[model samples]
Target: MRRARRTSGKAQRREVRRLAAASADPALHFLLLLPLALLHLSGRAHADLAAYGLVEALLRRLGPAAGWLLAAGLMAGLLWAIGRIRRRRLAWRGGLLLAAFEGVLWGLLLGPLLQLCLRLVSLPVAPLSVPGSAGALHGILAVAAGAGLYEELLFRAALLSACAALFARLPGLRGRDRLLSLGLAVLVTAALFSAAHALGDPQALEGPVFVYRFLAGGLLGVLYLARGLAVVAYAHATYDAVVMLWSSPA
Candidate 1:
């Protein structure tokens, strides 16, 4: 009985370690957010997705039920392919709970702190109108959630990595200066991330707004490097949700 207990305990500990690793992986982040793909198909709560555009013709042609299944499958397949590339196994339940907890923890904490910094510098801080044109409360939430997942994938996971590699190849940055390379990468990406708002609407490129997004983007970039996609995405989504709710009419 004692030997059996020891074996069981060892197995449990190993499982815990694996779960911890998987929870912090970008590939697992997609699996964790996989349900959002299904949720979006209800056609009530809408989110902006690049994949949705690719699947739009299918959606228009098929019956609602068929469209949902086809789209869900395609989304799942893409996630699975990415997961295989990253070598992540599914570690749901525990990882998901941790993701949500971290989201709530970091979201509320970082958001207000960013605002406090803005206030200190007297750079007009206001509640969201987040990227705008989301319309309605649900729409705003959807956009936040979409931005959290897709934007993080684009800016943090893809562009950040690309920038780091590019910086490493640059003249003065080529030598043992990892910190400088990372710093430059983060700054450039943060700038681009902030400026991306102009793509949604040119008029939103106000001075204060740019600064606000730049700060927010920098936070997200750092957090992504530290914690991984799940945490930063959820944190960003949660903060935007809070902002949108607070800003919307009663």
Candidate 2:
């Protein structure tokens, strides 16, 4: 009996260690990713601070297709990483369904509703009237496809999973760990999403309009949790598609 008890204790300890190593620490993960996200998103503004040459230099290091390809790679990696945790049966279907649902929600509901609300406030409207130009069409497509695959993969799939894993490790947080993890992931990802946009245009911020992006971030977070990352990405893509299609000439 004594020997058996000792073996059991050892086994338990080993399992705990495994869990800890595998656990997702949202704050830690966010810190790790924050710098990278800023650097990537601020590629434009950074260009002004001697970072412009760096951006160009980096891009120049690769072929013209590299940026798009890098985005594609991120999408692929996200799917693969998420698949590691997701049940096999629902992987593809779930992602597709999510994408579809998000597309409808953003295009038919959220985007329009927000537009109306903003209009009431006399904000300059993004017509989303039509595909403005070929480049715009391409950008829209990129955002849509990127949102569906890359965004979901990064924010929803990877980040959420990491949080869940971390939550499982802390004994004190056991009962509500998963929920806590999810919330942290959403908040961090949303912040990054907002920051990513904020780093752009420079003139992008004025009045209270910037709040829209934050709200959109929350929506995206909820979408990922309820529907899956793919759905949010789809919604994101559709929204971009419309905006690009209708954007005024530069």
Candidate 3:
């Protein structure tokens, strides 16, 4: 009995270590966010309109079968890379809990702090226009959720990765140089994220709103690097949901 208990304890410790590592893996982040991405795609959410535009355009040009094939190939490639990098089994339950905690943290803390800062800077932040009808509310919620999944995928996963790769090619970039490269990548990506919003509607790109978005984007970019994609994705979604559902209308 004593021997059996000792073996079991060792196994439990190993499992815990595996879970902790898997929780931080980028591949696990993609897998966990996959269902939300599918939901967003199915719901036809407008919040991610700019994010999905290029893919949608490609699909239209290539036709459904080819488009699907391309998408599948991309996903398979990503999964393959992830598998190569992170061979351990994922801790789905732990990841889910962490995502929820991050969401709450954003909703209750970081988001409010940003808003307060905006107010102090004399930039009147506009409330998201929540629709009066239930159907519209549901639609808006879907868009908000989609925004979380797609925006993070584009900005953090794709843009940040691409920028990092580009930065890695710079000569004499080692150690702190690498860190500086990543910092620059984050700033550039954050700037693009802020700018992407204005592309949809030029009039919405007022001084205050632009500044607010730029700051918000920078914060999210920093969070992405610090906390990994899953936490930041859910955090973005939760922040938007709280703002839309509870805050006064614009």
Candidate 4:
């Protein structure tokens, strides 16, 4: 009996740790996302890069070593924040794994996949643009940091939390109803996320692209639920980084 009780207690503690790491206010998450949104909206500055057609300029300024250092520092900050809340150590291995899966795998590959799917339905592809070598590398690093961390914070943490909170308030929701409400939240937020991207580039998708956004948003939402902000942020950042990197001339 004692052994059984200990196992149960240990399982409960583990669950608690996971939940704590994943929790964040939806609004604050959105606030973290402001810089990227602003960067996107900043016409002159954005146009400067677009006009230069240099993918590597900013990256050159930082240099490879320095750019990596910056990435490491940002990752550390993210882990530190997670630790403070959950009292869990984000091991280097786990960090790397998160970076590999979310940052590299999803960001780059998903875009193309979605594009292919959209083609079937007659949606045109958005031409990939990148900075010069120096700028491209650095831009990717910075974007990975900003977009990955901030967007996840906004959509997954703030948006999800708000929806969940709002849903929870209705007394009639219980069990299955509560689950349905949460699903509704995910759907609504996913639509908003898709809309946000559509605003950035109208011609970026077709029928398949819409499906892609929906799936990606849902994937992020689920990741937010399963792994917390850090994992999703890593994935988001990685995705942008790849897009920036791949878009650049080799």
Candidate 5:
């Protein structure tokens, strides 16, 4: 009995380590984000309607079945590419659970942090508004999920990667220069993220909201760099969900 318990404890510890390591893999991030993106693209949410209009238009052009098939293939290719590039095997189930836990943890932290930031800046913190109706609540949740997935996919994964690559190509960049280049890439991507919000809703740019978003974007960017895409994506989603729930009228 003692031997068995010892073996089981060792196994549990090893599994925990594996799961924690797997959570940092970008391939896992892609896998987690894909489903949310699909849900959003399926025309269920009003929040991303304008931003994802091009995707919606493309899907309409292709028709439902064909569009879904295309999206699946593209997502598969992306997963394959990320796995191949990283040369890492996935621990999908464990990674997913860790991602969820990380998101919830970060969500809890973000509210207090945001309030502190606002207080420091002497800005009045405004409550996020969400519709009280059941249907609208569902749509808002979908939008929050979509924002968590797609925004991180675009800003952190795609834009940050592109910027880093571009910066790496600059002649005479080496050592600390390369590090500085990557740092700059992160900042630029965060700024773009804040700016993109305003593109869809100009009202978001008003008052302290823009500053709040910019600060949030910067924090997310740093989190992405430190904790990988899955952590930040889910954190963003979880934070939005909490805010929406709090704002919804009783």
Candidate 6:
């Protein structure tokens, strides 16, 4: 009985390790973000989110009922794929739980750290734009999730991946030089990440805020590389949620 229990314990540990490792997979990031995307699609009030305009245009072109059918089909396909992953990796759950803890804990820690750094230069920090109305609270969470998921997909997954791939192809950057290449890619993407904010919110482009975002982007770039997209996305979203929902001026 002792040997049997020991064998079972070892197996459980191995399963836990495997599930933890699977959180880094982009597949899980997609799984985490998909429901949020669908939520944005379902409600016209959530219309403030990105790409809803494009999808809405599609609905107009295809007819509203037809557009929904298409959306349903796509959702079904995505869910089926996620189900396969669930069976393979324990529902890709490790990071999902860990993300909440990371989001809340890091969100609390990051603000003071950034403020201390900025205060050295005697510059006042810019507040992240958050709606103050009681009803806008839900909107705050939705926007945070959208921003985190979308920005990570754009800046980290697509842009950073492209930059890293480009560096890998350059001569004399082979072998352990991969780290150097990745470092460069992170810088390239972090710069773009900061700059991209200018396209959305005017406040984001202000001097103090821009610098804040650049620094934050750099940290997120490193975090994304280490923890993968799901962890980083949740961290970003939760940080924003903390700032907005908790009434903290980050």
Q: Please report, as a residue range, the 10-residue window in candidate 4 with the lowest summed lDDT.
A: 46-55
Candidate 6 versus truth, CA RMSD in Å, comes to 4.5
Model 2, runs deviating above 4 Å: 1-102, 113-136, 167-172, 203-209
Show where candidate 6 strays beyond 4 Å.
Answer: 1-12, 42-80, 86-95, 99-108, 116-124, 130-135, 171-176, 247-250
TM-score, candidate number 3: 0.74
Per-residue accuracy of model 5 over 53-130 as CA lDDT, tens digit each: 545576688876876787688868786857653576557678877876886698678778877888998998854322
Each model's lDDT: 0.73, 0.51, 0.69, 0.56, 0.72, 0.68
Clashes within 3 Å, all models in order: 0, 14, 0, 25, 0, 0
RMSD (Cα, Å) for all candidates, in order, is 5.6, 13.5, 4.7, 10.2, 4.3, 4.5
User: Tens digit of lDDT per residue, candidate 3, span 1-250?
Assistant: 9999999999999987776676676666766676556655556744446666666686788876876787798679677746745465567567556655765587457567777878888888753222222145565556666777778889988998799778877776654467788888888897888777876657446776667776777778888888788878877777776766665355
Measured against the true structure, the TM-scores of the candidates, in listed sequence, are 0.73, 0.49, 0.74, 0.53, 0.76, 0.72
Residue 112's C-alpha lDDT in candidate 3?
70
- Deviation of model 3 at 157, angstroms: 1.5
lDDT of 1 by residue, 116-231 (tens): 97998898884434654455766776767776666777888889989999999988778867978888888999899888777665654788888888888888888888888778
Best by TM-score: 5
State, as a TM-score between 0 and 1, how close model 6 is to the true structure. 0.72
Q: Using TM-score as the measure, what is the rank order of every candidate, best first?
A: 5, 3, 1, 6, 4, 2
Tens digits of per-residue lDDT for model 2, 153-193: 55567765676577667686776747777676677766665
Tally clashing residue pairs in candidate 4. Answer: 25
> What stretches of model 3 exceed 4 Å from their correct place?
1-18, 45-48, 70-87, 119-135, 171-176, 247-250
**What lDDT would candidate 1 get against the real structure?**
0.73
Task: Write the residue-wise lDDT of candidate 4 on 1-250 in tens digits.
Answer: 9999999999998865544433343222333343443443333232323212222365577787766875686577665555543454423333334333453455666566657756776756643322223254554566445556555666777888799778777667654566777787788887776656554456435555556676667767876776556556656766666777666578
